[model samples]
Structure formats: C-alpha cells, structure tokens
Target: MRRAAFGLFGLLGIVGLLPQAHAAGPSDYSILIISRERLEVATSCEIGVYINDQLAGRLFQEQSTSFNLPPGELDVRLRYLPGQVPGCQPGIENQRSTRLQLAAGQINKYRIAVDQNGLTLIRAGLGY
Candidate 1:
C-alpha cells in the first residue's frame, strides 16, 4: 500500500537525521579539567574553584574535577576555603582570578600549583 511505503520512507528520513543530531552534541561544548594531583600545594584545606565569580568546584590533594562548558572565555579563580582543618581559614590568601580561553570541542587541563604569589593554576599535559 502507498501508506505503508510512505511510513517506511518517513522512518528512513528520521534515521538519516540521527547521526547529525549526535554529531552536534559534542561540538557545542568544551572540556575544562582542574586537578590537584601534584604536591605543589602543600595544604589540607579544600581549594575552591570559582567560575565567573561563582563557586563551581572544590579540589583536595590528588584529586581532580572537570566541567563541560560552552566554548568561550571563562573567569576562573582558585583560593583556599575555610574548613575544620587548622590554618585553612579564609581571607588569608590571594583571591585573584585567571582567565581561560576555551574553544569548542577542545580539552584543557590544569593542575594546582603554588608560587611566591600564592595558589595558582598551571597547565599540564592531557595524556592522563
């Protein structure tokens, strides 16, 4: 019947669109990975990750977290958060933010590091 034939054609058309729908999914966002897997930051306090002035993630020693965000420039700041641990009190360190340029479908990796200035982010290899 013509109706059956038309239904089969409609199903084929829908199937043809599946690959395009999936292809657009990953290209819409970028991956941002922040890690504390190094010994550069010798502290017991949880470090707060601020994105656009909002607390987005917390990292401890030997730990890492990631986010899939839309491609663009992001304002990222790292600072020590006040916790039950002694000497981990807030407002005693710098609160400067770092600017990151992320492109669509790209992956960025950074590890926490410390310098004479204070806590900072250092770019690292993405092999891990």
Candidate 2:
C-alpha cells in the first residue's frame, strides 16, 4: 500500500538524519588543569592558564580548574603574567604552548608550575 511505503521512507529519512547530526557535532568532554606541586614556588601568585593563546583560567598553588570542551585538538599554555587578570599577558619566560588531542568520554588533566623563570606545564598522572 502507498501508506506503508511512505511510512518506511519516513523512517529511513529519520534514521539517515541521525548519523549526519552526530557527525556534525562532537560530543562534550572535560579538561582539568592542576597546579604542579612544588614547595619553592610562590603560592600566593595566581598563575594564568591559556588555551589556544586565550586566557581560560587561573591556577593557585595545588588548585585546579576543569573546562568542558568539544572533542578536538587544543593548544594549552601556562604563563606567569605579573599584572594581568583574565587577559593574555606573558613575558619571554614560562610562556609555552603544546597541542593536545581530546576524545569523547575522556577526562584530560594537566599541571602547571611557576618558578623563577615563569611557568611550566606538564601532562599529569591520576594517582590511585
């Protein structure tokens, strides 16, 4: 019957649209930024955190911030900006960026350290 054929076509159209929608949008994920542990570094100064050269968060000593991001590649950096707040400001030292690939349903964590020169970022382990 024509009604049965039209219903099947409509179901096929809906099923086809699901894949296209899923492919176009990536799943949401999270990235956690932790301050690296060091006794010699100044704890009072809030270090600047950047993603893709943009100021994304501030890190205090032994503190952390988590950001929800889409699945993709991101440029992460840490800086020791002396007089900047929620802005990208950095000197020659301690200003570096590296690319990170993120997948869905994963929680990526990184650490930042500040010393005499400036800031240092490193991939961290989740201690059990």
Candidate 3:
C-alpha cells in the first residue's frame, strides 16, 4: 500500500511537470523597416524590401513596415521598384542587402536610404 501511494505521488509529480517540460519560450523574431530617405521621396519611388531574396514590402518615404520572421540568418535587401515612379530606375546604385542572425523574441529595426554613392541600409533601432 505504501509503494502504491508513493507511485501515485511520483506519477502526479511527473504529470505536474509535463507542462513546464513541453512549454517553449517566445520564439518570435521581428524586423521593423523604415523608409526615411529623401531620395526615394524626391524621386517619387517606392522602395522594395526583400527578405531572403523575396520581395517583402514596398515602402514609401517615411513609411514603416514590420515583419515577424523566423529566427535564423536572414538576407535583407532594399531596392527601388522600377514602375513605382517616374525617373526611378532599377539601378544597382539604389539597393542594399545585409545578413542578420536573429534570436528568438528579438526585434531589429533598419532604415533605407540613398546617398550620393549608392543605397544603404542603416540599423535604426533594436525594437518596434
């Protein structure tokens, strides 16, 4: 009878721990994109945001976009959409790409801009 009682208690204890054992921490990774370059506005073009070589967003000047991404190495690129505006061409000078190793529940922000030299992606903040 004592062995049976002890086994019951042990089984209950294990059952109580099942939730904790299976529970996972937050695994969401996010990226915030900001298009604040005067160049895009001046040229009246929408910027194409790419993730892993896929077009993710077409951001306008001063606009922002947020994405929930998988935690891993991501290739981020920004380019001008060719037909979005007049005088806006698909020039290599107006694009940028970067690889980021993101962790679970982490958020990163970036800004796209165009300078005299070329396009650039600048890290803007850590969250939101």
Tens-place lDDT digits, model 2, residues 1-128: 99999999999999887855335555567655455555435545567778888899876666778888877898887766565444435445645577888887777776775445556666778664
- Backbone Cα, N, C clashes tallied per candidate: 0, 0, 0
Per-residue lDDT of candidate 3, residues 1-128 (tens digit): 99999999999999887865456866676554455643444656777878888998887776778888777898887777888457777755634477887777766776776667555677776442
User: TM-scores of the models, in the given order?
Assistant: 0.77, 0.59, 0.64
Candidate that would win on lDDT:
1
Question: Where does candidate 3 clash, by residue pair?
Answer: none
By how many angstroms RMSD does model 1 differ from the true structure? 4.9
Order of candidate numbers by TM-score, starting with the best: 1, 3, 2
Model 2 alpha-carbon drift over 4 Å, by segment: 1-26, 37-40, 83-91, 114-118
**lDDT by residue (tens digit), candidate 1, 50-122:** 9999999998889999999999999999999888899888766776889999998899999999988888889
Error of 3 at 85 (Å): 2.4
lDDT of 2: 0.68
Best by TM-score: 1
Off by over 4 Å in 3: 1-27, 37-42, 92-96, 126-128
